[model samples]
Target: MGEPQNPGRERGLDIILASRAYDLGFMSDWGGAGNIISTLYSAKSTNFASTWAKIETKARTELANELALFRGLE
Candidate 1:
């Protein structure tokens, strides 16, 4: 008899994606706080929106690649 395949193994990607998403979310939230602090202290505020957009785009691209790989494995 062949060894039983563990269905839970496929969920590893899902866990990774979820963790990445959470980190991105937290970064955005913290960035907002930084922007507010800079404004309050009369400090020059950086353009975090553009930087975040670039990061988000990259994440989306990577997520697509991961999905493709997962699909191919099925």
Candidate 2:
């Protein structure tokens, strides 16, 4: 028995990437500040796309954890 993984981590990474992208310039704070208001004032947000492609984020995070455990995060 153990704690389930926090899927919010994936969204957090997405927000970080999105914040830096050209489509979301106004939405700074690295996703810490969330709202359509903050996100709306963008330079050009017509095609706002996230960099962290879902499964990739999960795989990367899981792989990171496994690697850490192998190196003794166990």
Candidate 3:
């Protein structure tokens, strides 16, 4: 994907969304550290509850992708 117009500002926004996602993830006891971190980094701050949902979905997708090969071996 292409970078934002202002990468520095976009990075700051990512950090803000990440912190929020981390708190939500911790409170919910969801996913492992890698998933949590990935969700945080990938989250977009469109809204509060919706953003959490997005993070959860992203985390689950990432986890499934990571384990897809193992699952297929079953």
Candidate 4:
């Protein structure tokens, strides 16, 4: 096969981040988790993997369509 792939390179994480961002609300969405933190945080309260998947799906479907249409005009 070709040269061994770099383990550091991440692809699915972006999709997962996209999904989890919507799900976890990234640092920007919903207040970056800083806005919500009680004296005791039971869990990490964020699932970036899922968030990325959700956003990736949406962007691939809706945003992709919009971009395709917009680019065609040019």
Candidate 5:
């Protein structure tokens, strides 16, 4: 009989596929914007993943700050 598949591995693969699809759609719609911003900022590389990580980090930090402020008001 064939070996059983690992559910963890299957889930990981699914996540990777979804991430790739998202990246493709994002690039298709805003790919040129990245280039323009990079040029304006004098960035040497237009790495999508790096830019996305920075944006996500900023968003999370902002959200956390806002939540903390709201909680203090209570």
Candidate 6:
């Protein structure tokens, strides 16, 4: 039998990407969650997973850097 796989990883990634995209204002001013979702859907492609991973890494790094700066101000 094959090994069982972790199912949440994909869902987790989807949530992360959607949240990050929303945070980054990847939507029109008049649009809302639906627009964000549509934008993400339109961005889907064979390389999208790789692109999303890169974006996630960059966001993590930026957030960590911001936190460090904030801590320094204390």
- Evaluated against the true structure, the overall lDDT of model 5 is 0.58
Q: Alpha-carbon error at 14 in model 5, in Å?
A: 42
Model 3: lowest-lDDT 10 consecutive positions: 25-34
TM-score for candidate 4, residues paired by index: 0.32
* All candidates: TM-score: 0.32, 0.27, 0.26, 0.32, 0.30, 0.35
Q: lDDT of model 4 at residue 35? A: 28
Q: lDDT per model, in order?
A: 0.57, 0.49, 0.58, 0.49, 0.58, 0.56
Report residue 25 deviation for candidate 6 (angstroms).
9.9
Question: For candidate 2, lDDT tens digit of each residue in 1-74?
Answer: 88889989899999998887453322332232223343445544433344223234554555566567669944
**Candidate 5, residue 47: lDDT:** 69
Candidate 1 total steric clashes: 0
lDDT of 5 by residue, 1-74 (tens): 98787879888988998886344323432334334455436776666566666565555565566568779999
Clash number by candidate, in order: 0, 0, 0, 16, 0, 0
Q: What are the runs in model 3 whose C-alpha is more than 4 Å off?
A: 1-51
Model 1 per-residue lDDT tens digits across residues 1-74: 98789888679878977776444333443434323445535645476665556455555666576568779999
What TM-score does prediction 1 earn? 0.32
Which residue pairs come into collision in candidate 6?
A: none
TM-score of candidate 3 on Cα atoms, chains taken together: 0.26
* lDDT per residue as tens, model 3, 49-68: 55456566666765676567
lDDT of 1 at 45: 49
* Model 2 clash number: 0
**Candidate 5: worst 10 consecutive residues by lDDT?**
24-33
